[model samples]
Target chain A: MAVEVVYRSSRDLERLFMDKAEADRHDKMLELAEALASALQNAAPTLSEKQADDLGIFMARHRELFARAFKNNPEALAELPALEKN
Target chain B: MAVEVVYRSSRDLERLFMDKAEADRHDKMLELAEALASALQNAAPTLSEKQADDLGIFMARHRELFARAFKNNPEALAELPALEKN
Candidate 1:
């Protein structure tokens, strides 16, 4: 079955960064981070306490990457919901 | 600034799978895969042909994980746009 792909974007990362590749990587990383967050959140009720803690730690470890991805795109940054203040 | 995280779900993985942790992991992986797909799509216009090829290869490498994630939830699988046939 063909899956419907949705490309949702509020800002253009390529335009914001001088390095287009960097922007691409950052954009991808941010999306991955969000996906990870959603997965964790959705599974929260069923996750064992240890699994939950592990997921939390995983997020904390990668929080910097997420922050960096958003640094130039405050508009996108504003859209991020799981980013915690470091 | 606080980011608004949107958890959009059409099916519950936990309910579909007898193993809840596996379900959580699958859900998370699927989300990550989508995010990766979006990143690649958004950056396509600017990506060097080589970079594009590399990203495609990366997706190919992980496609199994994605397929496994969607094994039970065909609805979620239907939502996936990047899962190429193997």
Candidate 2:
């Protein structure tokens, strides 16, 4: 009989972003989207195809908020992470 | 009126991501979310507060898809971009 040990590591998306602030912004955006979707679902359990389209429009409009937020937080965009030169 | 030249620069979120591949992934994720939301809205033009909640929940659920997609693209996570050693 052979025993195998499995190891699992934490899934941190921070690795994808340039810095902690950027990652934090992404996390907040996801949370906001989730909250909005949940609120919509609770208000109307049933949605027609047309209603779905409206919801999407709302989301698209709100997406601009991310850029606006970034504009207000110039520090987040102050400098690009220096890339390694090979 | 005093003539003032105003300059506008491109708002590139790619600067936030670690690399081009990571930025591409983020862009795809946003596009998919917008599409889904748009489809949902078109299907149902009107949504109550509860319906909004449902949409938020849906967005939250799909958020995990980003991680799953990343897992399939291990190259995106191969190694962190080396930080500048000051």
Candidate 3:
């Protein structure tokens, strides 16, 4: 079986931010996550195991980040940078 | 049937950022997303409809913002603000 994977790296972050226009890495991540959900809302039935896994990774990462981007947040996001191992 | 809803507002964004701690608003969002995915990774088969819908809305919004928060982003996240309406 294909191994479960995780995304990482500055480049991964850069890829995640690929669609962002500018000055929006924070906001766009949420939006892209939304789009993924929209896709899932319509795609749950047909998504493959691997596809589902991919989406799962995508969504979890999306929410994880969303919850921690507050202005009053306890630590710098730089410490918890995006993954690169995937 | 419950409608396919969207989230909005500064408060929603604030809620989203709730787990963020202090900062970076920029990086924590991604982490939160990952956590959500971890949850999904474990709970997909049993998630309730409303629960799924809520999760969908949450995910979409997350992706949307993520893709837009780049340093060179065109618009500020403040402009797109999270949805407040249920």
Candidate 4:
């Protein structure tokens, strides 16, 4: 079998990445997600922990758009795909 | 202002991408997330609509690792970062 080198994010050891940069990026993303979740919980105490986490990760994943949306460009949110309605 | 060209995903007109390929990819990801949310709701009728959408998008974002974990490598999930516990 061919040997392969992979890097694992310290924050998420279950994932293996072919590139160190990618691994670092993944770790940073998770860090941001955690922070966002905490902030969401603090801002809306009524929100369930899972709901906060779900929104946190979702926002973290699309952080660029969110950042823009918050920066005098609320219209940026309209650029986001509409979530499926019940 | 300098002129700029961008691509808008048909399914998500609010967002613009510098690259057509990236816009297409984003669109496809959202499509997958929507389908996943529907399936989740169908399987777990008690889940709130937002919960299902949140989970669907989360899974779609990490589809690679999830696919590996589902394919007899459950340990792969362990590599995922632990979300904050309330």
Candidate 5:
């Protein structure tokens, strides 16, 4: 077998990246997601950990639109860009 | 005073906007800020209300950078654009 090198995101060892930058990015995203989840749980104790984690990941994935909403263009929230199917 | 028609953001009665769109945007930003403040307070009870509000506004204003960080580019947090002086 040929030797292959791949960078694994520390956040999720299951996934591997061809480039270090990509792995770093993924790790960063996971960190932000955790922060968001923690915040959500803190503010609303009624929410389960799973709910908070799911919401956190969702927000992190669509954060650009969220940024626009926070940036004084709430209408941007309604305008979601088309996503590519894997 | 000249007869000037201005729009006011319901979020903050003290501020007035020259355009309706601008007012709407400001209102939206305030709404987001409030949500963020609530989250901050919820997740971290040690933070005072004032501190939460201040941080919320700061995050809301610089949401683009925050979004980038959430989108797997945490380095974006270090790349802040210069703000215009009023």
Candidate 6:
């Protein structure tokens, strides 16, 4: 028998993950991001100026380094260093 | 001690975000994306031309609508129309 449960948007997928990656799943996220990035390049033919700007900004934030933060635990942002020293 | 299982790099956090979002965690993705974008703009002060170009491209793919595709289920990509006709 299968049981279905409702999930709320507020607490949805947003709650999981960490700074470098999840306790268990980090590689998959990298693969998916790469695939999704490829898809958008091929599928999206046109976008307005602002739309393009949003795209640029969003992509930069999903850095392999910082994304790890989101990967380990989504709430890890609080503990991540505010600045990455070069 | 918490039992720690090894996660394969092939299946990391990268696999999670769909084109638009995820099922239960769609809003979280959006919120976090926004926060992440802001953090990068403030934190990273240097980048080469290629790095900046990559940023522009990645941000475009995370459309609010397409992200919904991810939120519903991560595997929905095969079904996502190769081209979303305007």
Query: Which one is best on lDDT?
Result: 5
Candidate 5, residues A1-86: lDDT per residue as tens digits?
A: 98899998768999999998989877776777777666545544455677567656755666766666655555554454333122
- Per-residue lDDT of A3-52 in model 1, one digit per residue for the tens? 65333333342345556566655555444444433443342233344443
Model 5: which residue pairs collide?
Answer: A42-B42, A42-B43, A43-B42
Error of 4 at B73 (Å): 34
lDDT tens string, model 3, B18-68? 344433443444444444444453445445454445544444344444444
Candidate 1 lDDT, tens digit per residue, B1-86?
87553333333423355465656555554444344334433322333344334433433334443333323221222234443332
Off by over 4 Å in 5: A81-86, B1-26, B29-86
TM-score of 1: 0.25
Tell me model 2's lDDT, rounded to 2 decimals: 0.39
lDDT of 6 by residue, A1-86 (tens): 87654332222355444443342234444334444444444444443343333433333234443444344333444444566442
lDDT for each residue of candidate 6 in B1-86, tens digit (9 for 90 to 100): 98654322221344433343242354454445554444444444443344333432333234333343333323434545566443
Instruction: Identify the leading candidate in terms of DockQ.
Output: 5
Task: Please state the CAPRI-style docking class of candidate 4.
Answer: incorrect
**Candidate that scores best on TM-score:** 5
State the DockQ of every prediction.
0.02, 0.08, 0.05, 0.03, 0.14, 0.06
Report the lDDT tens digits of candidate 5 across residue range B1-86.
68989999878999998999999877776877787666545544555676567656766766776666655555665554433122
TM-score (all chains, Cα) for each model:
0.25, 0.27, 0.22, 0.47, 0.53, 0.27
**Which regions of candidate 4 are displaced past 4 Å?**
A84-86, B1-86
TM-score of chain A of 6: 0.27
- The worst-scoring run of ten residues by lDDT in candidate 4 chain A lies at A68-77
Off by over 4 Å in 2: A1-86, B1-15, B48-86
How do these models rank on TM-score, best leading? 5, 4, 6, 2, 1, 3
Residues B1-86 of candidate 2: C-alpha lDDT, one tens digit per residue: 88653322123343464466666555554444444344343434454555544443344234443222222321221132222111
TM-score of chain A of 5: 0.84
Candidate 3 TM-score versus the reference: 0.22
